[model samples]
Target: MLVESLAVLTLALLVEAAIGYPGRVYTAIGHPVTWIGALIATLDRDLNRDDASPAVRRAMGVLALVAILAVPGALALALQAILSGFGLLGLLAAAILASSLLAQRSLHEHVAAVRDGLRAEGLAGGRRAVSMIVGRNPESLDEAGVSRAAIESLAENFSDGIVAPAFWMGLGGLPGGVLYKAANTADSMIGHRTPRHDAFGWAAARFDDMINLPASRLGAFLLIVAAALHPWASARAAWAAVRRDAGRHRSPNAGWPEAAMAGALGLRLAGPRTYGETIVNDAWMGDGRAAATAQDVDRALALYRTACALLIGLAALVAITALALSR
Candidate 1:
């Protein structure tokens, strides 16, 4: 089972990297993440009552998380069971489905768009492109700010959007990937400290942090390795920055990759930034240059691509080892 799971993970990464989820398919049938989001929205509407006590809302949030995971988990298991009977074809189908959970190609495209926007439309274009990937206030950002924000989003999402899902799928196959996506989607939808969500989103936020723990470290390690391979980047600096600054960032998991990318590229990230009217005074991730430009964004993207390639290589290695042991 472990061998099969790792094989599926390797193929899924390859598939997603080759071709991302298509826009036409998304328009026609919606996405797995969107479907999960819709369910979360409904649960929030029906169960997360404004008038309810905090304790009750917290309990309901837990219930909502369970419900959110159960639906997809069961379906993934059923689908896996059915596909297993089909032999190699079943594995391919499962890999295709699992590929949707990852964002390797999409992340690269989005980050590249930020650099393209800056070059083409100046700061305004960069802000517009960066806004799509980050939750921070783009209008408040200057050229350097836009560049840093794009790099930060790329680094953090490298863990959350790529590594985490792949890690889970490599362990538990379809069900693991689906469940991680469901939890991650839930966290993004409702995991805020707002008055309405602080209690209600408690479980989703905490669970996401917990499940992401291993991937966060692994992602930082991959970035470090990629840095070593890059001519201009420094693996030693990346590792040092992770050790020094990853623990200081506001988020438990985001800082790991952000710090590694920052050090690898010799740019600071995740410093104090504004989201709406709110200002988050977080510590800088690296003691490097803070004046990040579109060129810096390009460098970061290169490092990110290398890290992703490393992840695929690791999955392939694991799959091969598992297959050999099984035989």
Candidate 2:
């Protein structure tokens, strides 16, 4: 099962990486966000109450999740059928084609651009480069702020952008993988405490949290293993630091990898940030060593590259193990 899953995921990854996304009429309509939003609308129709019970809210949340899971499967089957209509091998080629969009190397290079910009042009340049990486307002940051923001985005999105989708897809094929990405995107766009989405986005946020749990810890564990050669990081350092500081953040899962990353890099992450109208004051982690300059950002990138190598290498190892075990 693991071997089959890995083969499928690898094919998908290669597809996305090579040809990239095709701008097709159906694909634009069937993108993950579109489906998630559709599900949210469908789910919200039944729960249009100012006084819905907590039980009712939770039940509705669960129901919404059930629907969200099916959307990816539907998209994959549809895509496969279309590709197969042209030729059976076309379906296989399409799997490889779609994998080109996964963006492993692209993510690394884009993040690295910030560090290079900061080095070449200082804070203003860093801000310009990094604003592209993060969604939050970045116009107001100083050099240190820009560096911190980049590091934080680098660590967190590494989980969502790379690890989580791969993990799910490696387990459940393309449908599972795509749906996980879809769920995460829905949570990011709509999951909030604001009035517009409090109830409507409830299911997405919770389900995203549930789905991210294992991947987050795996991220931390792998970071520890991957960055083992770094002076400040070891398995012990990562484990102790994560246990001590992960609870400091607001999110149940993000704190684990972030704290571990902070600990591994000998820096702090998470604190005050504004998202739109909200001012969220989150607890901090790591030592005050997190007072980062651009130099520290470069070092962090080095660590990240090291960690990424370990992650991909580990994935290859897991694939081998699965194939061996299945035999």
Candidate 3:
């Protein structure tokens, strides 16, 4: 299972390396959340009706992952035997799914649109882009705030959209990768600290944390490795920033990629960002390079490119290792 998983992931990654994203990726925009919601619904169905504590929510979250791995993985394997296109199709699907998780081109373009909008139209145009990509309050944001929002999204998504799914696909297969995305979507939707969600979404949040644990660190390391490739960002500085700042964020995860990205991009990231009406004072990540301007956001976009290429290399390595083991 492990060997097969690696080869398939490698093949998918090679497609990304060789050709890049196909044109139809935008079709699934924000739609993974629907599949993710369905998984949470299944867990909610079996959740202990007796005690709806945080513990129970967490148990349900685990059960959701178990549910994800069990069903889709079996179907994919079974389909592989009878279907000639199964392997390639599965590989393609895995690649597309993995590509969907990344925001290199999309993040860059979207943030650039915001910057352009700010220059061309006004704050209202900036708000539109900020509202679309970030979970923060868009109306109150100025140019600096808009840049900050975009930068934060770039850093955090480096973990969620890219690292987490790729790690799972490398560890498992297409179904494994897709399932991880679903788990992430569930956490994003249900996992909240609010009274309405703290009980109901508790399970999703914890599971999200668990799944992202290793991937976040890997993402940080990969950022350094990726920076080393171009010297656009400092590899040693990324390591130092991650070691110094990753633990400061509220999440056990998230901060690794953010810190690495900040160091790599040579910008300060994650301080105070508004979540809806809430103004949370997040501790700073990175080496506190506060000279960040709108252009810094643009450079972070380039860092994302490096991270994407680095991920493809990692996938190829995983594939090669798998093939060697199979022989």
Candidate 4:
């Protein structure tokens, strides 16, 4: 189990870094997150009835979360048992499945698209590009706002998309990773506090928050270390910002990485922002420049890539250590 787990973690990182989830594969099978999303959506539509009491809706959410987790959890166990028989071939298949659960490449692509859009078409283009990735009101964003939004999304997603999944995979192998993904996908699909989801999505939101706790801190730690390596970013500032500002965000977990990234890059993030018709007066992270530009976005991406590399290297070291200890 340890050997296969280690093998899957290492190869999945390499595979995702190299090609990501191929568009062809996505076109064929949709993505695993999307598949998970469909299930969540189905549950939300069927079970999250307006007539249901708040307590009942919340219970239904818990049941839905359990149902979503059980399917992938069982499959992961089965796959591990079957692969344990085939040796290296089984490990390779497990690695492939694990890679699908990661979002390193996709995250980069989505953020890069925002940068490119800003560069190619100015504020309008940048707003349109960033809107695809963020739930904020794009029309209200200026250039700096758009750039900050992109950087914030990159930082937050790094924790949720990359670090969180890898953290689970190390402990629970492929199913652990998939289980985390399911929780995350459910959170995104139905976890909002709006009238439609506030009650029904309570469980999904809370579960996602609980599962992401450790990875969020780990991700922030990696970003701080990565900042030490970059001439432009400050490790001290990252740590300081994380301590000071992470608690200010609405989410119990997301602010850690966002604050770290903001401090590392010397750019302020998570300030007052518009979300659809609402203006969220979020506390600003990092006492740095708020007027971000395309160059800042690029710099944030550079910091992000370094952080990601640092994370993968650490994961490799952990895998090696686990394999050695198991032996």
Better of 1 and 4 by TM-score: 1
Off by over 4 Å in 1: none
lDDT of 4 by residue, 1-327 (tens): 665676688888888988899999999999888888888888888888999899999899889989889887888788888887888888888888899988888888888888999999999989999998999989999999999999999999999999999988888889889899989998898888989889888988999999999999999999999899989889999999999999999889989999999999888999898888998888999999999999988988888898889878887898888778888
| TM-score for predicted model 2 compared with the true structure | 0.80
In model 4, the Cα lDDT at residue 68 comes to 86
> Model 2: how far is 275 from its true place, Å?
2.4
Where is the poorest 10-residue window by lDDT in model 2?
Answer: 94-103
Which has the higher lDDT value, candidate number 3 or candidate number 4?
4
Q: Which candidate should be chosen as best, given lDDT against the real structure?
A: 1
**RMSD to native for every prediction?**
0.6, 4.0, 3.7, 1.1
Supply the TM-score for candidate 1: 0.99
Which residue ranges in model 2 land beyond 4 Å of their true spot?
11-67, 78-101, 231-236
lDDT of each: 0.96, 0.71, 0.71, 0.89
- Model 3 lDDT tens row, 154-217: 7777778767877887786766676677677767766777654566666667888999999899
Per-prediction tally of clashes? 0, 15, 1, 0
Models 1 onward score TM values of 0.99, 0.80, 0.82, 0.97
Mind giving the per-residue lDDT tens digits that candidate 2 earns over 1-327? 456557666666555444444558336555445656676666666653547765666566666666666766588757655665665376466556346325566666777888888899998789899888876577767777788888887778777776788788788655667777768866875567666567666888988999998888887787777567776555566677789988778998888778777777777877777655566798876665656777767766777767666766666677788988888
User: Alpha carbon lDDT of residue 117, candidate 1?
Assistant: 99
Backbone clashes counted, model 2? 15
> Could you give me the TM-score of model 3 versus the true structure?
0.82
- Model 1, position 64, has a per-residue lDDT of 98
